[model samples]
Target: MADLDGDFESAESGASETYPQQCSALRKNGHVMLKGHACKIVEMSTSKTGKHGHAKVHLTGIDIFSGSKHEDICPSTHNMDVPNVCRKEYQLNNIDDGYMSLMDENGEQREDLKVPANDLGREITKKFDNGETFNVTVLKAVGNEAVIGIKCQTS
Candidate 1:
């Protein structure tokens, strides 16, 4: 019998682990990187295999921030990269020509950020004009960040 207990060892203390995933494992509403763009998968379909080929998977996704649609086809067994996504809350501080400033929970300010094009974005625009400090949800993935939604703070 082989020593199976020691076969699985933990990685380096602070090193993050990332692995490729098969196309068939993807699901709708999942975040993935397509053509170097961070997108959220909106639809997915798989086709039966032909005479001598493998099954093909069709994926349609939209840019999380830009709302642009992108589609691609790949073998069901094909490997795809999945991006790490995070969401955080922040407060609107100011708005510039094409960017808005935000302050985090720790009072740290980030300026000159383009507002996303979505309901939350529209709400932010409307609230900013009235000098309101609303809570904003930011989605971070694949080294990019964008505003996803706004939260109304209640006293």
Candidate 2:
């Protein structure tokens, strides 16, 4: 007999990560779950019904945090997972060992995010080294979050 004693309860077990949405109702620039990634729909088109099949909706999306592309096709009447995505801004506080310290408007601090290893990271580092105060935009979805943008604080 196989053992099954491991506790697999997740911290967000009580929260629903995604909601069901009809494929045909999803629009471009909306949020979607493609291949297990939370993405923003960049392009969408519906193809006419085939010989004995229903109409298909083709989707092309970009992963909001990772900037990766994902695509999929499904019958227009089928249901698809639409992730609950949220964006929040925080004041940049510090950076150390590739991790960043950020403070929210209420002064709550968060230090769990890593500096992206892409062009954005380089830009962030440069701005920080130059002593430019800025706000970081963090995108959260599907139990994951990341710093997606930065904006200088204006007078």
Q: Pairs clashing in candidate 2?
A: none
- Model 1 vs. true fold: TM: 0.74
Candidate 1, residue 9: CA error in Å? 32
Most lDDT-accurate candidate: 2
Mind giving the per-residue lDDT tens digits that candidate 1 earns over 71-99? 88989998987777779988887878768
| Count of residue pairs whose backbone atoms collide, per candidate | 0, 0
Q: Lowest summed-lDDT stretch of 10 residues in model 1? A: 10-19
How far does residue 100 in candidate 2 sit from its true spot (Å)? 0.9
Off by over 4 Å in 2: 1-13
How high a TM-score does candidate 2 get?
0.88
RMSD of 2: 3.2
